[model samples]
Target: MQASQLSRVLVVGASAAGLTTVESLRRKGHTGPITVLGEEPHAPYDRPPLSKQVLSGAWEPERAALRTREALSGLDAEFVFGDPAVALDTAARTVRTRSGRDLAADVVVIATGVRARQLPGQDDQEGVHTLRTLDDALALRAGLLAAERLVVVGEGVLGSEIAATARTLGLDVTLAGPLAAPMALQVGPLVSGLLADLHTERGVRLRLGTGVAGLDSRDGRVTGVRLATGEALPADVVAVSIGAVPATQWLEGSGLTLDNGVVCDSRCRAADGIYAVGDVARWYHEGLGRLIRLENRTNATEQAAAVADAVLGDDRPYTPVPYFWTDQYDARLQVHGFLPADAEVDVVEGDPTARRFVARYRSEGRVTGVLGWNMPKQTRLRRQEIADAVAAAPAH
Candidate 1:
């Protein structure tokens, strides 16, 4: 079916996904009134560097924005900042912002991205922080500069990066998580074990298989965290980043499926006249025959492009491979494609002790994913091979 020529398109969320969707719409010849609403006070910007560059105080928040006002103004798209979406009236085709303004649109794309999951009863305490937005990073960075003891909760990509960053600032840092190692979900058990060893060698306390019960605070400032085992880890600051939930609280009453994230077909379309993208959208994989939600920036841009095509009468679904990267303590790790839990892992080159290598994950002799440490070129080649294989697979 040919999509109606979009005249009034409202994109809620001004980050990578929302901005990309609007830009794609304009590039595809949709010269309608496109209004982009962002809860962040700043315009859309890049986020990958927030932990490495911005948190180190080497870069400012402006450097992270994807597009400047001049670039956005050139497209004739209206930009609204600092007003968070409070509710969505899908039936009325309007959205209500916290500022008491109603935004009407012929089509609405929800790109309200996820935020870092904060610890309950601790998230609001001073010196306890979560890093997702620019403001969050600024606060955490400030704390890190003066902090003597830093406790990072979670061994995921963000948490590891934060631990590395804290150590770079000469802070005594401890990395703790529920898992036995770091990046176990993606790089698998073996690689995660090596990573734990690397952190320990660098004088960073790697506390694995432990979970936080609560944050101990006095006078509204965090003093330490209590462990699930009834032990205490004293810290001047704590950063919790277990995972992120979709920013779909405003669409709670909207008549669309909300399972973990907004469920959408390949093209990013959800309910009638509505679409969801970024970390907030759960996508259906035809090959895997399952719904998957990805938090990578690449997926966000690809899905946003698909959303633009869907809006312009194209039915192309986002079927790209998932890829992510992390930088910890001078080591760079990159991965492409999804590796099944049962997949066999192959250590192609480099030893964990040497700290540079390529690993390939395969299932039944067919490559499923590739992990690279200082071998980005090889990783990309293997990833492309997997993508080709998936595309060439026969129809069921």
Candidate 2:
């Protein structure tokens, strides 16, 4: 079906990706009916701020709104909030909701995103929390306000950010993870080592290089985190920032490929008339010659645009240089493209000691990624290198 030929569009998961798909379709001159199904009762809101601004009380919950009420109303899309999609029939292009409503559309875009992974017995503990949704952030903020000491499990981006935000909010925060340093797997050793210093200098304790055993609770309230080495770190509140898994439970029997996420073609199409966007999509990357899924906020809109084009009968492959940014303490880190664990990183611009620099990552003699620390403009300029490298890469 062509753009104008699409009779009705159904977007499952009304977060950033789903909402953007709706907006993009309309912007691209598709006047056909659009319906967005969301699991959350709230309108589509940004998720990045939930870990920092919302958690620190710096920004009101409403400030994270991706679009104002008037803007959303102007979109002319029917939004069914709080109705989670429970089942999908790819053959019929129909989605059955938890509320027993079957929404059928000519095209169905899956943007259900991912849910935060939790430690064992996390839900049974009162003080143990995971920061994924808006409600989780608010509840954690409230808990932090009353707590004195906080232990953040999993020292990745989310865990590090949560520790930074909570520490800024006057909580004695300790970050624990199995990695050698925070974001070790993401940004690699050199930068993650610097992150360790940053966290320590900011009074955030680091309990790295150890795996979490479980939560120790008293009276159904979390008291501390037990490490694999039999060491325990006491906490008034515990935040688990372990990774997340793609939210594809509803599509289990839908006959669509589901690996770490909904596997799709290079154009983000899972099947005929069915596509996926955002973190829920593990689409083939022609440039990298592999299936990749990005969990950052940027992918939500970028992939949505790609899927929108695909739905409109555009055959261009949806290959993009992945991008993500993180703000912790006084540092803002930006990354473009892939950063393999063994990638050789070099200071391309500015000095690392100054905490304002750009690092370029190369693997197998090919520029694969760029890292920017507090230099957004220069980093963006350097991003062209990654783009050029991606273009030069031979497709499989």
Best by lDDT: 2
**Model 1, stretches more than 4 Å misplaced?**
1-4, 392-396
* Per-model TM against the reference: 0.96, 0.99
- Candidate 1 TM-score, true structure as reference: 0.96
lDDT of 1 by residue, 1-396 (tens): 244555799999998999999889889888879998999888888888888899988787788878777898898989999998988888777999999999999899999999778788875689998889888899999888878999999898888888888888888988888888877766788788888887887778977787888889889999988889888888998988798999888888878788889998867788778899899999787765678899998989988998988888887667778898888887888889877768898788777668788888888777778888878887777788789766865554
Which candidate achieves the best TM-score against the true structure? 2
Task: Show the colliding residue pairs in model 2.
Answer: none
Overall local distance difference test of candidate 2: 0.94
The lDDT for every candidate, in the order shown, is: 0.85, 0.94
Task: Point out where model 2 deviates above 4 Å.
Answer: none
Model 2: how far residue 58 lies from native, Å: 0.8
